[model samples]
Target: MLAMALSTAPAHAEDGYELWLRYHPLATEQASLYRSRASQLIAGSATPTQTVTRKELLSGLNGLLGREPTSSDTVTSDGAILVGTPSSSPLIASLRLDTKDLGKEGYLIRSVTVDGHTATAIVGNEDVGALYGAFHFLRLVQTERSIDRLDVRESPHIKLRVLNHWDNLNGEVERGYAGASIWDWWKLPDWRDPRYTDYARANASIGINGTVLNNVNAGAEILTPRYLEKVKALAEVFRPYGIRVYISVRFSAPMEIGGLKTADPLDPNVQHWWRSKADEIYKIIPDFGGFLVKANSEGQPGPQDYGRTHADGANMLADALAPHGGVVMWRTFVYSQTNADDRAKQAYTEFKPLDGHFRDNVLLQVKNGPVDFQPREPYGPLFGAMPKTPLMMEFQITKEYLGFATHLVYLGPLYEEVLSSDTMAHGQGSTVAKVIDGSLGHHTLSGIAGVANIGANRNWSGSDFNQANWYVFGRLAWNPTLASRTIAEQWVRMTFTNNEAFVKPVVEMMMGSREAAVDYMTPLGLHHIMGPGHHYGPAPWDASEARADWRPVYYHRADRNGIGFDRTRAGSDAVDQYAPPIAAQFNDVKQTPEQLLLWFHHVPWDYRMRSGHTLWYELVAHYTQGVDDVKHMQETWRGMDGYIDAERYQQVAAYLAIQEKEAQWWRDACIAYFQSVSGLPLPSGFAPPQHDLKYYESLTFKNVPGYSSW
Candidate 1:
């Protein structure tokens, strides 16, 4: 429906401070059509949430329709937009819309005749649901959807849709491509930045109900009284928008902050300290969303330090928060340098045995893949393995491995790939989406978290195109099964122009962008070959890290014979972690998906591929194709110079230029390293690397943005 083109004139320069909530005036025809249906607004201010819902509706309608809707207690005119729950508004209660099935956060929007006047009712079971409904209604208008004969009933499939901010207390965000942390701890508890409210609004607009406000590699200082007051201030600002604030807590906080002798979960003293801390936090921020723990992984302290299991650690925190109606989101990203097992199988091995060991309030937050957020990976084995435990899907919205902020790698496709993966735990149709949505496991508690790309940058994310990653993550977190292509199209319409010509190519670009990244960066199941520490660019030969797992060479394992990790039964037996069907597929080199052939098996350089080409030849082809795709993306973007605002269009064009250059760098560096290792001649008609292997290896970055040290 979004099919209007811009007039042939110099459009205004729009710095992307507005994000997807950019309620810019619609095209003249679309505005007129929408205005007719949203002539008047009837919403209550019975609570803080209802008040903000009314404010947002008026603001969005005014911006989109070129006029504010008339505020009325009753439907005085045809095409009035009515919003609220039964308890909040008398008009909504009189409609007698069956909201019993809608639950606390679900909403129903329908066209109904009230007092002989035609009106659109956005009713929900709760005020927060109505707020969600209001945002949905605005989305329909922004995307140019018809409001007439509306009968949309929507609810979040997952219970807790959250954003995990890897932000530190001192204004730094680990793996954060955007600027510094937006929490503004220095000014908080006094000077509340307007950006905080905007942040909450943007999150609530997309149905993200909670946010963990600090880095998962947390510091003990966050639990201190000073920081609690600051966190309390943020909770207040976000509360009106129905977003609860969560904190990532250090497992050793009982000793580091509480002045206890031991932080053991089994100790009565340690339990009492945590219980008191929970009480203190709840008293400060009553609706606080509870703790996100990253214990015994990557040098972070946890219950393992005290000889307790992951469940023991998580349940302890869960018990502390249970009386307050809070939850514990325990991260399952555990891998030990001491253990000589495959890194990908460690999380599953540790948690699979403790399926029902965790308390009801505890959610095992698992990354979408077994490995860290590589451009591509098989869905995490833990998704289906631990049926009794509530597994929370954690996706990284920030392009940490996909060229940080510069590359226009929309992650919707990647998310779709992982979510739609057939885990085959229960049967053929069992998907990771089903596992996390609680449909497969039948768990009452469920969650999905996106590691946030948000920051203090005006555009929120580092680049203009990068904002699409954040938008897509939030939309998909609400309902994981929704097509990524559909979400991309909706985002394109809402963020930029709705013109058919502009929308078609741009959506295609976004949908294919992730695959393009996977192709160039880690084609054919190549994983974690990025530079050590910063992970900025290709470093396949980087064997300099102190730990073997931290080295790029450790992951690729390229020798004179082959270039791949052998994760089959002959190797680490990592394939056995998946369900039987998946394990069988991954174990046999012939049966495995070509994309994941290298991930599961180490093949000879001359091994035959499904394409009838040698493995080495296919690798070279995939790398070359990735570069070509980026070039194609540049060409497609160049054609739309006049379709949107010059500022955004030009910036995107510049970023694509950067992406093309970097894609070439990845292609060249990787090919050079692999060629050196495999001793293979380039297939006919294929170009050699831009420089020699030595030249690629000599390159070093002193200051990459997203590096945790920076």
Candidate 2:
């Protein structure tokens, strides 16, 4: 009925309420098979946790198969999918699935003969794993993968797959393009929305096991008893989906919230306070994931404030949680005003020397790029530098610098670029993926966290296309080795249509979306030229900011003679941090990849590029080509109007129109400004800017959507 209701509506008219969990009816034959095979769900006795799992199975099956599953206490002879842990179900215990190898969160799905009847069993070593198994089975049905002869066993390669929500207590999400924060802190604990269940369902579907609920710019009030009750309610909703809730804690919480004189890590009073706080949190939410601290960075307090090391700060929290099986994720995104060195190399300079000093429960969460999440950046050098420290890769899925939600940029390729980059930690094949997944470094624990794009928008992410970024981040976090194109194809099929005519072209467009964004926003390896504070559009002319790194001009260093920052021996010597082979490649402009040519070297405008055109000419061509590509994307989507639902079709069509206008704005503004400085003529046959550099620089937006801090 839900599917029929959705199908009958005009395609363009939407509440965006369903998101990717629409579960529209399958093809006739596929629907028939699914309906028959999933006619009943025979789950174990209902505990509070099992009740949650059973509800998800029933709801998801009803939506996809067009009928509710009949549940039973015992496995039936016909048409049944059994779900439970080994201890709870005899069917699961009989499978002898080598449960020892599953660790804590792995599951096994197999087509087996149960009590002389043909049935499929989703078995696990624990109840949480059973919940994970149920979601995996549902995913197979949603993606139209074959259910016959199923023999699937999966365990997350990374220990922690988390979405770090940059949501503040005020309900405004920082760099959040979708809408307001999902957490209704004011109504929580007393009033629980059913949408929280759906949020958990969506995450569980993708194997994302954890969520850091608050903004890294944390507030001390979150630790208060009243707020803990609200957090407990959220944690309860997420628990059945195998999703644990973590909180971003302010480093000064002990002093601010606990009425202490100082928040010193080594202070006996401070240590006792954190220990008691951890005890209180565990009492409310027993499986609380732990604390995510952004300390000694962006003015957040830390041990460094008291003349101590990062390890000192992180270890203090680790000691408090070690008894409760919790871990402390200490962010390594640090910079100091006193340091005259390049901002790119600051995190490494601070954390690398204290490699083995951290407690076992502490993980230094490092961003993928040494700098902030730029459009294109070399993998952070710290990935390989810290052999003894467990490092978790932090990636931004929200597109703060990559044109926010309005632009159709799939971040799969961006994530893959960093993950596959060789760190050369142990010579060849030492990729950043291997390092964070604990293979290269042989660390006991590992993780990959994505800054979530989710908000209160009915679509989950603001635009339909932005959903693919969230989908891709989860898929990559689960495996880390999946090809970006493959993930795009899967998402296209699941979210849009399985029709080859529609899927093929849509996926191809998605595969190239990120690169197209890079070309238009920051071409030829240039980084961080977007407007300061709200990084929505072009602001290369912007130079006024309190912090030097906060300014656009601090990054590009463009001028009348040449462009780009030189990180080579003659300049910052940042290249020296890389392995010798990679260092040599970046040191020479000719040897560096054309995509990254401007990142490592600043060249004369007249210098020749690999395209056989002068650097200035090539730059103009790339910017023009980026605009042209958006035109092509518009045309491609226009041709698909008849292929998808009118609602989704027109939604994308409208966004593509916005993209085209913005693309032109990016091209015209950037080219106009760059030409003013370079003093170069436009390449032959390229269209000239509609306005001069002064006009472009004068434009300002006082009010833009999604600019509110979280």
Candidate 3:
């Protein structure tokens, strides 16, 4: 019987290979409406970009309208959709659209007339822009939006919108949960997978203009000629889609791959080696999007290794790529485990002094938070501090800290929180969004990256709902000011059923997901208390790591006296890094926002909360609220049975069950550990842990995957 069970085949299911481009046949009424509006596609030229644009329109029209639209070079019908750049199509040129205002990657879609026939024209200054416009048109029909009076002008606000793949050379993704690396390095330069084109299509549809192919714990061999050939092949495939390829280079690559004695940024020989290497790379790939370096942090060699600063290291590389029209994204996620300093204060302490020292093309790629990607963290202090330099915001799309791929935590709210935060650099209204988008201090270069959650999984991201994070990342990357709830609605409409009955509840659940995780996992700015290496389940009792800061106890400092790390002037003085008003608020326990009260103050269990409950009671209430939220989500998902496919619906339902169990585990384990420390009883109505603290502590996971921290 056991042998028979092992031999059983998996059930047939709807694999998530299609992503959000699911142009399934629309409802009957909507299909008729779309068919009339999208009658024929007039693709004027046969450029690679235009060809894909036409093909995509045909595919989308055929799938959504239930009948393929006629393809032609001329306006053969009244509802012809003409698409091209002005230089490529005479009809677009005759329209005399103000394309001068639309940059290379911007497009204008208007309901216009050509050849005595009423038609919709999608015109751009370049072919890639038209391709983006084509995707936009398909999305409208797919989302069942009316395109009758279309006159939309669109462009990405930030100069660089990129996805940083934490993939390694060995087909292993550092923090990937979906599956193995998608790059398939061994098969790459020879076999161009059809998946690559689809990946490009997915990115281009949402205005992602760049991708880093390797992990920041970069291997030196990726800079070798052998891998450069492979990279060139990918460059060719992604060029038409307007995505430039960037590589995360090992800082000591000159020595690791070039047989140099030293990689000192100030060394003349090392500089020459990098300059020659840049020229060599440009000769093979002219449109290469420069290098991303992880140096002096996490044991990666940098200018600091040679007694030089970060500016020296970044400026050295910036000079090498300057002649090639490239830029260096020097990461600002620096900290030292060897030092007993506050982790929250390290990045700002290092980079704040060197603001005006970096070269013209160098951007300090700062993480969204001062510390690592916590469930809830204050916006990084560096956003408004560096007035003379460009700062790119980095967000982690992969849920390393939040229960990996299984938990349904949407990060849109987390991202929106950080982006909308007021850095207060120049008094009122100086938001982090304005700082990174080059509007705060009026700097030219700006970029934002989501450490990609993508992998070889059929669904792109591991689970069905996880794809919303990827979708929202792209949308928010295009325009930082977009409301996350609005993006959620757009995704729900496109990916799942557009029923009003389904969309509202689903969007509400998604909007609250991040906060729910915070309440259950690490509420009120408490962070990094998960399992030591794997970061799987709750481990508030962990303090056994070699480095003190890596342990959960070091972060929470939960004892009989109180709980929470004190970052005010009386403690680590980390609050001093923020602007004066913000600093003062964090310094005072009463003035500090309750959501971040514990982050700045270590209060006793008897301390009063804004809710009129003692700190201990409120904490228990929050943890209980988190578990209850999961139950509500389970009920909500159960009611959404008929809205989506049976396979995806059942998959989400099973995951919700897993999440409920995990949320309970988090609540129980954390509460039991805290109760042990505070010597306090559970609040009157709150339930006690299902098991003792020892039972939760004994639950060790030796093989939980996606634990890559670097």
- Cα RMSD of all models vs. native, in order, equals 3.0, 2.4, 4.2
- The sequence of per-residue lDDT tens digits that candidate 3 reaches over residues 1-710 is 21112112233456676678776778899999878877888885477788778777877788778877788777777888989999999878889888887888889999998778879999889998999899888888888888987999988778899999999888888878999888989997999877888888889888899999999989899989999999999999899888999999988999988999999999999999999999999999999999998898878888888999999999999999999999999999988887688888999999999989999899889999987898998899998789999999999999989878999999999999999999889998999889888888788889999999999998888998998888889988989999999999988888887899999999999998888999999986688899988888899999889888789988888889998889999999989999999999889988888888778888898989888999999889999999999999999999999888898999899999999999999999999999999999899988899999999988888657766555
Query: Which wins on lDDT, candidate 1 or candidate 2?
Result: 1
Residue 184 of model 2: what lDDT?
92
Question: Which pairs of residues have clashing backbones in candidate 3?
Answer: none
Best model number under TM-score: 1
Count clashing pairs, candidate 3. Answer: 0
Give the top-scoring candidate (lDDT): 1
How far out, in Å, is residue 44 in model 1?
A: 1.0
Report the lDDT tens digits of candidate 2 across residue range 498-518. 788988888889888888888
C-alpha local distance difference test of each model:
0.90, 0.86, 0.88
Against the true structure, candidate 3 has what lDDT?
0.88
Q: Candidate 2, which segments miss by more than 4 Å at Cα?
A: 1-14, 69-79
Q: For residue 693, give model 1's deviation from the true position in Å.
A: 1.0
